[model samples]
Target: MAGGRIADQVGRVLGGRYRLVAPIGTGGSAHVYVADDTTLRRRVAVKVLQPALALDQAFLKRFRAESQAAAALNHPNIMRVFDWGEDAEGPFLVMEFLEGGSLRDMLDSGRRLTVSQAVLVGLEAARALDYAHRRGLVHRDIKPANICFDDEGRSAIADFGLARALAEAAWTEPDGVLLGTARYAAPEAAQGRNVDGKADVYALGWVLLEAVTGDAPPVADTTVATLMARANQPIVAPFGV
Candidate 1:
């Protein structure tokens, strides 16, 4: 995904204030950078859309979804978005920088959290979701990759990119659309139906299950018919918590 010097964009300055320091991570459509906000004199995470994604009208719409939803939220467990604007590279969303890395890292290390630790993480993340849900937002994506930690190892939910509001719920585009990560998605979501707070709660159950089991959920090939059919199916858990 990184081109020659494009990979070396660490020293570049964006929007005349944010200076890129290093690459932090990447998503389906953006590369995240830890940048110094020269104007504010603090470090921030910058999520810049890839050139290919920036050029797609559809991706731009989804990008705007996260920016708008996150900008409206002000909860402690939810990642805070400070500012967003386009630079020469592409459109970027500026957010607070958290150093504790992601929950995916924790899970991948093969070290399971104690029962109490896992409970605490689940509580904090659930609070974040409850806060947003009360305000009519459904965070469609809730896999490990989107759950990060704070300096004290507290769980925080990031990347509300697939979040959809209840009133104007647009579950699908003109063509068929499955808005979230298939493995964690609620059945209604895969069927392109309006999902409520229940969908997020369901996803959290999967997150916690993986935390204790060290197993990734299996994903069947996602097709319109199959995805919708999953709605009528019952999921059998491998083990009891």
Candidate 2:
């Protein structure tokens, strides 16, 4: 089989249980598949690490460690991790499958959400952040692509792939790669500084502003410069959609 075909097949019987149905999305570190858990007879979102990322020992270790920590946290607004382990192929994560598409996609449809709707989404995400912060976990990456909704329209934060557990006291700085979306990133993260839960709050505010205004806040060309700028400015009110 070709590489893609083999990946399709390996995805078929991940961990000798979950049967991959189709690829739902792909990120820098992993690919998410809609899968059926044969043993439990239920659906799940399966995240398989990219081969390139799997080859990086540091990334694999951080991936497993952060996922394990996230799995320990249970909340209504956070995507729940059901399992995390390495198969012969590579590392993978089994999580609750949320049916609704991402916030980025919704916004791209050109439908401006009402202020209440935006607040509801932001509030739910805020609660999730509060929960994670209490547990000393910082979701280093918070962007529209990482925020998802379910069938009933409840918001859940996704993509903990960049998550770091503060309790562990092991920090890995982001290198050349941008750790988060430029427009929504907190100034601290943009500046390559070590961040905590407040960074998430800043990012959430930016997301809420965009949700209501349909426009992203202006950002400086450089990440450090951007954080400095954000520190000085007051929150801008959302423009009428």
Candidate 3:
């Protein structure tokens, strides 16, 4: 479920502007909804932070700061952050609505992309990552779920979240704790070492591999196992890929 009643949040208005229309998706950190931006007279996606994260003052502060920075990012392959605000429930971000779903969705359907298709998607995402990196922002989390497509079949990166902010804030997670998906994390990220844009590149490589293979780069069942599996390994693209 999204977050208890949070998933049932429909017809609710936030900041007296965004009217939640329907729950679109859910992730560990937030629930995303398709909302109507009354002021802008357009449909937009609203990502509401989980109630637990919302209650943490430290996270809220960093989240807001990061959101502002992410919003400033301008690239065709980057999801545009139109606005952000807080309400009684939690802090929310208003963003461009992409109807093509995510790479995760496609791979989950058991259909793998062709080599050409995968490369195109990877190229677009790489461009977006490079742009963000040049601006001194590291995504920290780069995986299929964050690689979304628009109605036009163009891939764009989404959800530049607290993982990046927390890293920059120098806030440490307890040992063995992880921020993003372990399957896509770089060795440095998995080991809780300092990371840069290269980490994003590493993760994107995994995403592209998964895209063409229709399988995650072999990891074990447990989170720790997954982390250990890749922590000291080299990335090997499958033959002919």
Candidate 4:
């Protein structure tokens, strides 16, 4: 089935619980939707595994296992996973709904945030990464789009779909499919190698650089070969007022 049609079908209720409201965003492996949890009587975010991924037994197993691992991590700065289960359609994860929107939106708005505001965002993200790192999880995807801000201005790291426990196999080889955003992916991740907390730190640095300068740092390539080549290169100073 075509992806769009599959997405449309999944838009209907699954397991008689979550009612998909609308698609919030799409990542490399899944589509996130704003959903209403009938059982709990509140809104939540539902991430539906992509049709291609859902059909792959190996990938589906890893997806569910990794998501379960991520669920064990609970922090104020991390989005909470309420549940995970499979339906006739596919696998899905129910997560806390955040209203404000993604950091990517803020950056694209062309609003120049004060250094203090930017720093606060960075701090919250750093804290979240620290917590995850301590728990032995590495958030392979930490770009602005995955960092969400609530109405109260609190930053929460939203997507752990690409996150992997430190002990797990880092990537699905033979495909050479990189799992994260090109611009913000760490050198190790870009190279399709195992990554640790330092990768998250590098991605966070890119986010901070973007927030301060209103532009993402240039990348030589989305691959690890290119990333490793320029990983240690110094960043340019922020634009002066």
- The TM-score of candidate 2 is 0.81
Q: How many clashes in each structure?
A: 0, 1, 0, 2
TM-scores, each model vs. reference = 0.84, 0.81, 0.89, 0.82
Measured on C-alpha atoms, candidate 1 has an lDDT of: 0.74
User: What TM-score does candidate 1 get on C-alpha atoms?
Assistant: 0.84
Candidate 3, residues 74-172, lDDT tens digits: the string is 999999998888877777899999999988889888878899998898889889989999999899878888889889999889987556654544334
**Residue 195 in candidate 3, Cα distance off native in Å:** 0.3
lDDT of 2 by residue, 1-241 (tens): 1347544653468888899888787654557788999999999998776444545667667777888788888899999999876765557889999999788878889876798898889889999999989888888778888899899999999866444422132333332223335567665665668889998898888787777777876766665555566666654666543
Ranked by TM-score, the better of candidates 1 and 2 is: 1
| lDDT per residue (tens digit) for residues 56-138 in model 4 | 66666776777787788889999888888776555778988999888888888886557898888888888998998888887
lDDT tens per residue, model 1, 1-241: 4655446889888888899999888654568889999998999998886554445565556667767878899888888888877766767889888899887888878876677877888999899999988887668778787888879886778876543421133223312223335667788876778788888899888888888777665556554544665577776676765
Name the top TM-score candidate.
3
Top of the candidates by lDDT? 3
